[model samples]
Target chain A: MAVIDIRIDLKKGVADPEGNNTKKTLESLGFKGVTDVKAVKVFEISLDMPAGEAKKCGEDMCVKLLANPVIHNFSVTVR
Target chain B: MKPEEIRVCVLRIEGTNCEDEMADAFRMAGAQAEKVHLKQLTGETFPEMKRNLEDYDILALPGGFAAGDYVRAGAIFAARIKSALGRDVKKFVEDGKPVLGVCNGFQVLVELGLLPALDGTMSPVPTAALYTNDSGRFECRPTVVRNDNGGRCIFTSSVERGKLMMIPSAHAEGRLMSRDLDFIRKLEENDQVVFRYVRDDGGKAEYPWNPNGSESDIAGICNPAGNVMGMMPHPERVVTRFTHPDWTRNCPGGEGDGLQIFRSVVDRLG
Candidate 1:
C-alpha cells in the first residue's frame, strides 16, 4: 500500500483574497518579517495499491475534481 | 409538448436548498416542473425515485452548496453529474432542450463544462470557473442585471435588449473567470453573454453593483446554441412583484422583474 498527498493552490495570477487577509492579520500581530503568504489545500489519501498506481490515482483525482484547472494548479506526491 | 405540457426538471442534490422555489417558478410560468434529486436520476437510491434525463423538456439546476462545497463550490456535484448522467445531459442539449443554472447552480454548470461549451455541446473539461469573490465574503444583496444576450439566449427572450432587471445574488464564490484568453471575445462574437451586472440607474457598475467582480462585468452567460445558461443571480427568488427589493416604494402589484426569465423559457417551449 502507498500513501498519496496532493497540494492545490491558486494559479499565479489569480487573486487569493483569503490568503491576502491572513497575511494582513499576521502583519498586524507583529510578524513583520512575513513578506508573502499563500494558502494551499492538502489532501492525504491512503491507497491500497503500489506507489506508482497511487501517484496516477492522485493526479487523476486532481484533474477530475480535487483541483480546478481554471484558477488552480496542483501537485501530487506518492510514498 | 405545449408550454403547459412542458415537463421541467428542477434537479438537485444534497445541500441544494433552492429546488422548491425553482420548481415553483417554473410552475408559475405554466410548465409542469418537479424537484428531482440527483440520486433519483442516478438510480442510486430508491428504485421508484429513478428518473431519465430525456424525460424532461427543460433542466434547471438551482442554488445552495452541494456536498457542502468542500473542494470548490460545485466541483463535487458536477463530477457526480458527469459520471452519472453526462451522456444524457449532452444528448438533452443536442436535442435543443433548455438548461438553466442559477447562483450555485451556475457554478455547477460551469464545473460540469455545460456552459461556455464554446467549441462543442459539452467540453471534455471545464473551460471556466466561478472563483472566490473579490470581497472575500459571501455577498447576499440585490443587484441589477442588464440583458445583453443580443437574441442568442432563449432564456432572455422576453427581456428587452440592454434593459436592466433587478435580481438578488448570494454567493461566496461567484467570480466567473477563464484561463482562455479569447473567452470573453468568443462569448461576445457568439452572442453568448446573457447578462451583465449594472447599477440601478443603468450606469457603469462599481464594487457592490458588480457584486463579485466578475470579468467584463459578466453576470450570466449562455451556450452558443442558447439552450444552456449559467448565472450568479437568483431569478427565482424574485419571481413575484413583492419580492423586489424596492417593491414597497412604487408598489405596482404585478409580475416580478425576474418572472420574464422563467416566462421566456416557457414561451420558447410554447
Candidate 2:
C-alpha cells in the first residue's frame, strides 16, 4: 500500500571521501568495473506491506520531522 | 552620515547556515542588524512572525543547508515560507519593503513563489524566483558576474550596467528554469534579468562559470519592484577578506562583495 522515496545530498564541502576511497580499494583489488562511485544521502525506509497512507505519511515525515527544511531535500510516491 | 542607522533583520533557521556571516557583513557595512531564529519569533503561522517585518528596513535570507535540503533543495523552506511566511512577505512587498534571498534562501523564494515577480502587481501566487541548477550537482567557485538590472534593486544600485563582481555559489539544484518562453523574453526586455554568469574572458555566457545551466545563463534576479532579490551565489560566505578561494594571491577586495547588498538596503532606509 505504500512506497516512499527520499534523496540525500552529499554534505556541503564534503570531499566525498567515500567515493575516492572506494575507487582506490577497487583498483587495488584489480577491479576494472569501478570507475566512479559517489556517496549519496540515503533514506532507509520500511513501509507498510501495502497501503496509501505510507505515501502520505512519508511526505509528512519529510515536511515536519525527517527533513530539516534548512538543508536536505526529499520526495514521495505510492505503489 | 551613517545612513540613519538602518535596522535590518537576518533570519537563522536549523538548516540556514549563512545568517552569522551575513550579520557580520551587515555590521561591517554599517547597518544595525538583528539575527534571530525564526523559532524564537513566536508565531503559529509565518504571517504572525512577520510582526518584526515592520520593525526592520530590510529582510535577508542567507545561504546554508536548510531543512537539510529535503524534498528537493529548498522545498521544506519553501513550504514553511509559502503558506505560513508567504502572506507576510506579500505584505512586505506591497509596502515596498526590501528582501534578499541568497543560495538556499533563493530556493525558498522559488518554492514559495515570491522571487521573479514582485513588480508591485499580480500574483494569485507569485510565479518566480529560484530553480534547479541543471548541473545535477553542487558547484562552489569564484567567478565574475555581470549585473543586468541597473539601480532598480536597492542592493544592486552601486552596480554599473555590465559591471563585473565576484561571488561564490554552493548548491546541487541551482539552475533557473521556466516553462514559458514568452515570459523569459519579456523579463529580458524589461531588464528584469539581473545577474548573468560569464566567461573569464568576460566576453560571453559560458559553462562552468555559470555553474547552473539556467535559461539565459542567469545566476541571479530581482523582482520588478527591485526590492526582492535572489541569487545562487553566497555573498555572505565571502564577506571576510580571508574567505576568498584565492586569498593567498589577493587581499580580499575592500569590505567584500556581499557587504554591498547590505549597505544598499540601509541606504534605502536613509
Candidate 3:
C-alpha cells in the first residue's frame, strides 16, 4: 500500500482573507516581521496501489474534486 | 401549464437550512413545491422516497451551509450533484426548465459549472467563483438589487428594467469573481446580468449597499438561455410585507419586493 499527500492553495493573485486576518493577528501580537501568511489545505490518503499509480490517482482526485481549478492550485506527492 | 400544476423541486441536502422557506415561496407563487433531499433525487434513499430531476418543472436551490461549507462554500454539495446527476441537470437546463439558486445555492451553481456557462450550455469546469467578501465579514442586512437583464432573464421578467428590489443578503462568501478580465463586459453583451446592487436612491452602491463588493455591483446572473439564474440574496425570506425589516416604519403594506421574483417565474410557467 502507498500513501499520497495532496496540498491545495489559492492560486497566485487570489485573495486569501483568512490568511490575511491571521497575519494581522500576528502583527498585533508583536510579530512585526510577518510579511505574508498564506494558508493551505493538505489531504493525506492511503491507497492499496503502487506509489506511481497512487500519484496519478491523487492528481485525478485534485482535478475531479479536491481542488477547484478556477481559483485553486494543487500539488500531489507520494509518501 | 396552470400555476398549481407547475411542480417546483426545492432541492436540499444536509446542512441546507433554507429549503422550507424556499418551498413556501414557490407554494405562495401558486406552484406545487416539494422539499426534496439530494439523496432522494439521486435514488440513494428508499424506493418510496426516490424522486427524479426530470419529474419537476423547476429546480430551486436555497441557502445554507451545505456540508458545513468545508473546503469552499457549496463545494461538496456541488461535487456530489455533478458526479451523481450532472447529465440530468444539464438536460433539465437545456430543456428550458428554470433553475434558481439563492445564496449558498448560487455558490453551488457556480461550483457545479452550471452558471456563467458562456462557452456552452454547461462548462466542463467552473469558470467563476464566489470568493470571500471584501469586508471579511458575514454581511446580513437588507440589500437593494436593481433588475438589469432587460427581459433576458426569465426570473426577473415581471420586474421592470432598473427597478430595485429589497432583498436581504446573509453570507460570508458572496463576491463573484472570474479569472477572465472581460467577464462583466461579456455578461453585459450577452444580457446575462440579472441584478446589480444599488443604493436606496438608485445610485452606485458602496460598502454595505454593495454588500460583497462584487464586480460591477452584480448581485445575480443568468445563463445565455436565461433559464438558470443564481443570486446571493434570500428572496424566499421576504415573501410578505410583514417580513420586511421596515414594514412598520412607513413601508407600504403589500407584497414584499421579493415576491415579484417568484411570481415572475411562476406566472411565466403558467
Candidate 4:
C-alpha cells in the first residue's frame, strides 16, 4: 500500500480573500514583514496500489475532484 | 404542454436550504414542482423515493451551502453530480430543457461546467468561477439586476430588454471570475450574458450595488443554447409582492419582480 499527498492552491493572480485577511491579522500581531499569504489545502490518501500507480491516481483525483483547474493549481506526491 | 403539466424538479442535497422556496416559486408560476433529493435522482434512496432525472421537464438548483461548500463553493456537490449524473445533465441540456441555478446553485453550475459553455454545450472543465466577494463578507441585501441577454435567454423572455428587477441576494461568494482574458467578450459575442447588477436608478453599479464586484457587473449567464442559466441572486425569495423589501411602503403589483422569471420559463414550457 502507498500513500499519496495532494496539495492545492489558488492560481497566481486569483484573489485569495481568506488568505489576505489572515495576512492582515498576522501583521497586526507584529509580523509586519509578511508580504503575502496564500491559503493551501492538502489531502492525504491511502491507496492499496504500487507507488507509481498511486501517483497517477493522485493526479487523476486532482483533475477530477480535488482541485478546480479554473482557479486552482494542484500538485501530487507519493509518500 | 400545459403549465400545470410541466414537471419541475427542484433539486436539493445536504445544506441546501432554498429548495422549498424554489419549489413554491414554480408552483406559484402554475407548474408542478417537486423538491427531489440528490440521492433520489442517483437511485441511492428507497425504491418509493427513487427518481429519474429525465422524468422532469425543468431542473432547478436552489441556493445554500451544499456539502458545506467544502473545497470551494459548490465544488463538492458539482463533483458528485458530475460523477453520477453528468451524462444525464448533459443530455438534459441538449434536449433544450431548462436548468436554473441560484446563488450557491449558480456556483455549482459553473463548477459543473454548464454555464459559459462557450465552445460547446458542456465544457470538460469549468470555464468560469463564482469567486469570493471582494468585500470578503457574507453580503445579504437587496440587489437590482438588469436584463441584458437581448431575448436570447429563455428564463428572461418575458422581461423586456434593459428592465431592472429587484432580486434579493444572500451569499458570501458571488463574484464571477475567469482566467480567460476574452471571457466577457466571448460571452457577449455569443449572446450568453443574461443579467448585470445595476443601481436603483439603473446606473452603473458600484460596491454595494454590484454586490460582489463581478467583472462587467455580471450577475447571471446562460449556456449558448439559452436553456441553462445560473444567477447569484435569490429570485425565488421575491415571487410575491409581500416578499419584496418595500412592499409595505407601496405594493405596486400583485406579484414581485422575480415572479416574471419563473413565469417566463413556465410560459415557454406551455
As for TM-score, the candidate ahead, 1 or 2, is 1
Enumerate the candidates' DockQ scores in order: 0.84, 0.07, 0.66, 0.73
- lDDT by residue for model 2 over B57-102, one digit each (tens)? 7788878888888655666766666555567767877788778888
> What's model 2's overall lDDT?
0.69
Candidate 4 C-alpha lDDT tens digits along B1-270:
999999999999999999999999999999999999999999998899999999999999999999999888998989899989999999999999999999999999999999889888888888888988998899999999999998889999889999889999998999999988999999999899999999989999999998889999999999988999999999999999999998887558788988899999999989
Model 1 alpha-carbon miss at residue B214, Å: 0.5
Candidates 2 and 4 compared by TM-score, better number: 4
TM-score of model number 4: 0.97
Q: In model 2, where do residues sit more than 4 Å from their true spots?
A: A1-79, B1-4, B44-51, B118-132, B246-253
Error of 3 at B20 (Å): 0.6
TM-score of each: 0.98, 0.73, 0.98, 0.97
Q: In model 3, which runs have C-alpha deviations exceeding 4 angstroms?
A: none
Q: lDDT tens string, model 2, A1-79?
A: 3556665554343344456777888899999888787755556577865656676777776654444332334666454
Best by DockQ: 1
Candidate 3 is scored at a TM of: 0.98
Q: For residues A13-42, what per-residue lDDT tens digits would candidate 1 score against the true structure?
A: 999999999999999998878888898999
Docking class of 3: medium
Stretches off by above 4 angstroms in model 4 are none
